[model samples]
Target: MTGAMDKVGTTGGRKRRAGVVAALLCLVVAVLSSAILVSPGPAAAQQRPRTILDMLFGNGLDRGQPYRISPRYRITDPETPERRPARRTTRKAKPQNPAPKAAATAPDQTAAKPAVAAKKEDAKTILVVGDFLAASLANGLKDAYEDNPMVVVKAAANGSSGLVRQDHYDWSTQLAPLIEANDPAVLVMMIGSNDRQPFYGTDASLAVRSPEWNAEYQRRVDEIADIAAKQKVPLVWVGAPPFKFDRMSEDMVYFNDLYRQAAQRVSGEYVDVWEGFVDENDSFIYSGPSVDGQTVQLRNSDGITMTDAGNDKLAFFARKAIDRYVAADQTSEAPAPGARIDLPPIAGAATAVRSPPVSLDDPSLDGGEALLGGGSRAAGIDFEPSPRDKLVLIGRGTGHVDGRADDFAWNDKSSAVASDDKPVAFRGSIDLQKVRKEQGIKPPQEMPSILDAIMDDWSQDNSQAAGGAAQK
Candidate 1:
């Protein structure tokens, strides 16, 4: 009984201690709750010391300004209200400048407009764009205009570029930024070398040299041309040259046709480079006349790209068009065709005069004929036959007739020895036979034919036959 009483006593003491401890814990919780309720809001809390997490989240952004959505509400100090400049009580006066005389006469001169004055740009920028060919073209153009301060040649070419492959590089998108940045007066372009290949469309690939492909390619070209038009820059589209391969050259020709059509649609200048690099038969040539008309290698060994000479030749076609647009002094009006211009005659020049003709019968034409006792030739009387008869038969009517001895009768003026045929000593005498005998040369005899000899032989044979028969 004593042991049970002691146990009960111990248990009661433990319960009492536990109740005291529980009462203490309740008081502590109540005190903590009251303190939390008395704490400030989030905005106030942000003003307190920050943690490493808060610092990492917005260490750079969270500077002196307080967190605000709108720029007007943003403040350097949370306690201070931002101050703004006071509204003007009176209007401020603008500074006055003297008006230009031109502006007075033409009110539009002072008016605002989008068109840029051409003279503002000291030099015309010739922006050349294309493939590798354009690099050569740019280089040639630079050399061509090296001495001219008014022209500046520049290049923005992309190698292996073309209108057929917009996916590779879209010229329409590229030209906007290009023309904007360059602000060129003239835009020269010579692509299509890399375009003849098959065109890969969205749904399907178009075959090379196909009508559909050509149409799409031309559309791309038109897009590029339109960019220049929008920029108000004159575009000089250069045609592709004839390539080494016959099919490639033919495709280039078609491409040139499309370029020409697109250029015309946009009112752009189309430069024909095909003719300059082709022969009379329109075949591709590796060497041709360059810008200076010197014959040089125009194409590379690959036949696709242009050499230095080739590029110059290609640029030459476009140069004139570019010059026309870029040169402010160039006049579009041509002089009237076939207009006669009278120039002052040369000084001290004599007028042409006609002199009378001196005939062969004239004594003046005969040098010393009177001193030599020679008579002048008769002009009206013609002793010789017609020139036609003399040419037809040489020495005609000179031969003597066989039967008549007097066929060629001589006049009394003809002595035995004619004045022409006489010896020097007997020129006025008539002893010509003695001179002939002294010379010991026989006169010419008649030419004998074999027929006479044959007849004589036949008669002799007939006589011999008759004599033989009589003897028998």
Candidate 2:
């Protein structure tokens, strides 16, 4: 029974020893897992450990160093949705009316307001009369003098009226009334754009551009000028510019000629705007250099009407004549014709002495008889004519040099008749050897040819080989 008890105790001690070994292995495994979990990544692996305890614990030394965690590794709180930015919607509300918007955006308010403010009570009126083109000219003139309070542009134009359509709108009877009403300081007229039709009469109608038609047109134009002259108003007749149609432009040219004659006859000025609208070849153009020198469209798409820029250019040509009259009215008053003034008496007139007149043909007037440099020289000096003087006065030339391009003398023949004089020696050749010796130039050494150089190399190699064999 004692032996049995010893065996059982030995078995129990063995079981306890196995349990302790298993517990030690489990502790070692737990320590290894904790070290791996606390270790830094490869990037932080280069940092040194602060202490041996830190190395064992796998805590890398990051003291006093910046540590940034990547956003992918950052933990976000699920309860904080308000921290995110809200998205913006793209929907917009449409307006009910567009006209008010367009009216609010109307351009050139600064320019429009000043023009209205500049029209003073004492401003001088510039009366413009004609067809639709004259209406455009009026607008351009208004723009030209918008800032000048002293000048005012007024339009009395009839769009469908012309000299040919007297029955429709007669300018001869209507102009006198306009002049009296406006009492303008200057009268500007530009007609003939709509006058290319036949003139209807009581018995027979005159065809367009016919001799009878031209005579009647000139008569009507003359009558308009006469009315202005009678009213004592300054007239400025602006010529018609070229049109898109070739035939229409030709008619305008002829009309401009008549307008020029009539305006000149009345002692008035003519403004020719033809060259301004045409190109270098005198052909009609749609676009040209504007007043600011920038290229802009001058004519509308129809090619008959003018754009805003075109109207400004038309007024540019007529502005000078208009300004002259406006300036004349503003000029200071001259002295009255009957006014008289006392004049200062002439001084030192009675005792003044006069010198006798000299004749132009007298040589003594120039202080000598002979010409300059032709007077007598010193007694011992000799006077010889220079080569230039010989060539100029005697028509002779000096001798030419030999072998020159101008020397036309034959090589085998004498230049002058043979005389009993000795022949001249030729001295053109030179001795190169004597020149080289005097200059201390040495002769160059000759170099070996390709074949001779190869033979010399082979000979040297064979002699070396034979000496090596004897030494062996």
How many steric overlaps are in each model, in order?
0, 0
What is the clash count of model 1?
0
**Candidate 1 lDDT over residue span 1-472, tens digit each:** 9999999999999999999999988976775565455554556656777656335333223334466446766345555545433454787775698556675566675467544323224677889998877788898888666655567788999987888777788887898898889889889988888887888757999998678876777778788888888898888988877778998777887888888987888788898877788888877888877666688998889888778777667666767677766652322345699988776432211222443354332223324335422355457653344333343444333333322333233434334334435333433464656656687445478766899879988999999999999999
Q: Candidate 2 residues 1-472, lDDT tens each? A: 9999999999999999999999988987887676666766546666653556445553542323323335544333335655544565788887777545566567966767533534667779999999999999999998877776678889999999999888899999999999999999999999999999998989999999899989988898899999999999999999999889999999999999999999999999999999999999999999999877889989898888899999998898898778767732222336789878666432222222553455442324433456544555668654465555555665454554543434344354342223213122222466444554587435468899999999999999999999999999
Candidate 2 Cα deviation (angstroms), residue 120: 2.8
Off by over 4 Å in 2: 1-117, 328-472
The numbered model that scores best in lDDT is: 2
Q: Check candidate 1 and list the clashing pairs.
A: none
Candidate 2: the clashing residue pairs are: none
TM-score per candidate, chains pooled: 0.44, 0.48
Using TM-score as the measure, which candidate wins? Answer: 2
Candidate 1 — which residues are off by over 4 angstroms? 1-121, 328-472
